[model samples]
Target: MTTTTISEVKSINTPSVIQINADIPLDQALEELIRNSKEISITRGKRKGKFETGADKEGLELLPESSKERLQADGIDIQAGYPEAPPREDIPIYLDQAFEIRNYDVPFVDRGKNADPEKKSLFGAATEIINLTKNVGTEIVGLQLEDLTDQQKDELALLIAERVVVFFRDQKLSPSAQHKLGDYYGNVEVHAQVAHVPGLPGTTVIWNDYQVKKGMNLNFATSNLSNWDSTKYLNVGNQGWHTDLVHERQPAGYTHLHLDAIPDVGGDTIWSSGYGAYDKLSDEFKKFLDGKEAVYVSAHQYLDREDPFGGPKRIERVHPLVRTHPATGWKFLYVNRGMTKRIVGLSPVESDLVLNYLFDVYEKNADIQVRFKWTNSKQGYGTSAIWDNRISQHRNVWDHEGDQPRHGTRVTSLAEKPYFDPESKSQREALGKYLHQWD
Candidate 1:
């Protein structure tokens, strides 16, 4: 049996992360665990445990004593809180990539609300990030999704959480890599109501043409136009800004939409920052919206077509109009024009007025948004737009009216339900740059 030692650990670049190989001999496992735990204790200054008061909760947390109850041993090896993988339930989202996804570390300070924050600069990661807008969008280059180390992935999550949307050019990311990238940040979410790539389980196919499926059909049938079409297919949805899968309570966290097939002209997409919308609201308006909730319903789901992608019935959910970002503790206006049905606790007319005003805030504001004209280089490189749906809204521009069509796959990650915390700061306050730019 091969044994890993401290010298071997030091030889690798992982100063803080612990790499645990699966199915190792019990003796070797214990030795490495104990040795690594000791090494962690000595190196506590740079990286602190989850329970400890530290700069950032980016450090690994100790395995809980309670987890010991769930440990299983099979004569030669020990597995902690492990479940048997069913044969039929197996499909590799990321092919050729290998690594067990480690459990998420406890954040440094629960968004720095209760603990002292470690000093962090604008671009916290070592990746190349070019800001596309003052508040909303950023283009991240010099890195591929497949090549990200665990720590770098964590940092990228933090960056996108703050920036709202990060764009990539020429990233020929496969559906597997796209899904895996979403998994690194959170759970790869399968669309309950939309069609997906044939073999790729969670990767959604946003085919903007004839082959598109049942869900989101009304939007396609309407051709993203303002007026009613000849067929009169309900005539409203998705031409405006929207967050994907917001019809559910626990909305999608991160969305990696890869536009592999881009039209040469008129297929540009726009992203607006929810943080900017919230911050620009009047103090009285903000206070009025603080505890209020809104009900969101998907128009396409209720369309009079047979359900194409079969799943559970999509249910309308009530969520806070103003939501707090769990990672950064920043506040954003969460209401979107696409799916938002009504504001609860208000009269129908009052709800209409309020919702219309909120929609106006997102639509009229160009200061907090970035528009990207999608394209590929002369060589075969492509662009993908990744966004934090919780604090952002995106609209796909379909001005391209030729035989060439727009097509892409989108992967959405699951996150906690939309919520509002009175203590949460605005996006402007959290970043410490672009102050009052939106207002």
Candidate 2:
């Protein structure tokens, strides 16, 4: 029993039978921990005097209010979820560390493409979230959107924030439920700049279903010649990476997207960890970036046509390049390829040089990202990936043809405006203790 963060020492969805997913073999799990130990470690006092500005500090000294909320949130005991496990056991792990996989008999289902759990899977992503990637994602086994409970909603949000992003496979989540899920976090944020669902209010319909005209003759010769892929700095109509609605004065906290209609292989989406990106910066660069401001403009495809009723004339706001998470108190990079135009104080040249460099830092690193393939499951099946818009960036790859449907409803929830706190820790440090290897 070494010094551990509260999160590590406390119950992870206690009494819920939390087992390491069965699909993850022992060696693979250990390797993941080893990776966590190396790439994600942010131990206190590790960077003393490394930068001229000072050194990195570790916060999250206190467990959040959600920790208390977690206890009352559900009645699930640790044994219920995973009823099948081997007897209590332990083995000496890497060096001074040892991890024990106690195979206690519990209800742990590693549901993939065809998941039909008698009770849990049919419920929703909240009931059966399985860790899908090493660093960033968790897949909810077989949860139905309509079956989610109030406690599950709260638990799901907390868990998504934990994993950065969580996925639900074959979800039949209705637009109303999607909207309701958004409401669980905060008010349904209506987009001031992008197109919203015509009658449903607060929903955005982003798809490429309309057929191009078959009879092309007049402008077809030159029109078809202009390749969309060749266009630079063009907003390819939301295909590139972006945080949703960053142009708002107070950016949306959570964005939930359900891909009900996706092409078989071409419409996969990927998300990168802002917290990981922040952690990877050199101390000097980190010092230079922290507390710096960036300006994001909601122009291009985001121009607000709904400004007829005295809406915001322009969508623009200045936010810290690195911001602290309100709940976990972790610092995450806030700039994105889509909305962030320039670093506020720097000159145009300096901003472009530095921004391009930082963008490369994120774009080049695959370790901090998770790419997902959608099944576009039928009426009772599909996946809705929900994430903390504040601490992550995502983009959809448009590999499909124009006629293939990739339809989904999105709901954004409003939260506090962006602000950076010096005392914040990175997500690695915040959850490091829970990472068995680090603790």
Candidate 3:
């Protein structure tokens, strides 16, 4: 108490400090010494590359006193900072740069909405029939295929998308003209294997009668009815719940059929909405088919040989039991009569039971069905029907055999694959509302 040692006072330059070696200029080294309070055990010749610390004599320089002091003050912090963090190598210079942000949530709005009024009104007038059926199906009147304007063509496209199917009564269009009208929808491809009018290049005929031998260009009959189990000839028959030839890797997207010389009393064509078919199923059935897939094969009804139609014996594919429509984004049952074979992860017996039940449901629901009776109308000449194969099914009645010879030509389009949308609940609701009307 009587005497206090000067050593007790903190030294501005303490002897307890460890020596530091720095490969720097004398002036710069001196600055570091003052800044870190590090003692220089060895100094340079006051020039570059001449300095070396005592620790460097053997290996690396010892810790400076200032560093030790910092460590003692914050032991954890020092340890954390020095823990094996290597210098960043090959880092991208723009890693932290800002970018132009974009909003993807907003849907693209139709620019035609704000187009010039005069131009819009002109197109509107011609597309009136198409506009009227935007929410439901309608019969087109006072419009001929040959007389359609560009506006009318645009209107027809919109109508087909909304109504799913459109009927032209008593059309005076020849096979070629009808084919041209279908071209407006998209490119038309002749059916792979069907009767074609003689010398009519690009025309595929749909005549079912074997009696007519005049101007015989192409005469082909499906074996579906002839050989019940044979699916080859029936390859194109009763393609239930399917668009068209989905068994192919690329299926036809659109099909147009003209009812020329229809029987007087019978042979009406029936169409069922596959989208509606899915809506009518019980929740349990829907859930069961949600993730399941099936295999579809084509066979013949009449031919006994393996190569019934000189095509591949079986066309097998794996498609979801519930497929979504591409444009409308709505889900639908994908099973059909022509090709669907077996369900994945189910026994043969179980698959058959499930498929049969689904078939029964589609067959029984009259509300989801529309039967068009062809009657003589002043509208035009041939009774033509155009439908999107992506979401609808059609069948012909054999009852009109003896009345009037029924035959026509069809043009198919290879359009985009069908897809489903989760947001198409509104479309389903609208379809449900019209269920009773179909019945």
**Which lDDT tens digits does candidate 3 get at residues 1-439?**
1221111124578646334444444333333443243232112111111222111221112222322232233222232221111112211111011011110122222122233423443344443443222333445655566676666555554444445677767666665566676665554554322334333323455544421221112223432242233233332233223446565433455577776556668767777667767777765667678768888653211121322235323445566677765445557777765557889999999998898777656666786677777765652356777776656666766565434566566777545443344444534664565322221
Q: Can you list the residue pairs that collide in candidate 1?
A: 56-108, 57-107, 57-108, 170-382
Each candidate's clash count: 4, 28, 20
Worst 10 residues of 3 by lDDT: 95-104
Q: Tens digit of lDDT per residue, candidate 2, span 323-342?
A: 98766678898877756889
TM-score of each prediction: 0.65, 0.62, 0.57
Alpha carbon lDDT of each predicted model = 0.59, 0.56, 0.49
Candidate 1 vs 3: which has more lDDT: 1
TM-score computed on alpha carbons, candidate 2: 0.62
Model 3 stretches with alpha carbons more than 4 Å out: 1-137, 199-202, 211-243, 298-312, 378-380, 421-426, 430-439
Instruction: Tell me the lDDT of candidate 1.
Output: 0.59
Better of 2 and 3 by TM-score: 2
Model 2 misses residue 431 by how many Å? 3.7
Q: What ranking emerges by lDDT with the best candidate at the front?
A: 1, 2, 3
Give Cα distance to truth, residue 7, candidate 1, Å.
73
Residue 207 of model 3 has an lDDT of 48
**For model 1, where is the 10-residue window of minimal lDDT?**
42-51
lDDT of 1 by residue, 1-439 (tens): 5443332344465565445564665344543453335332211111111111111111112222222121211121113211111121121111111011212322221121222233133245326778887777878766666676665556566777777887878775666677777776666765433345444557765544422221233333354543222123332324556777776546678888887666778778888888899888877788899989988764332211133124212246688989898778888998776578789999999998888788878877999889998876734445788788888888766566424656666888877767789988887776675543334
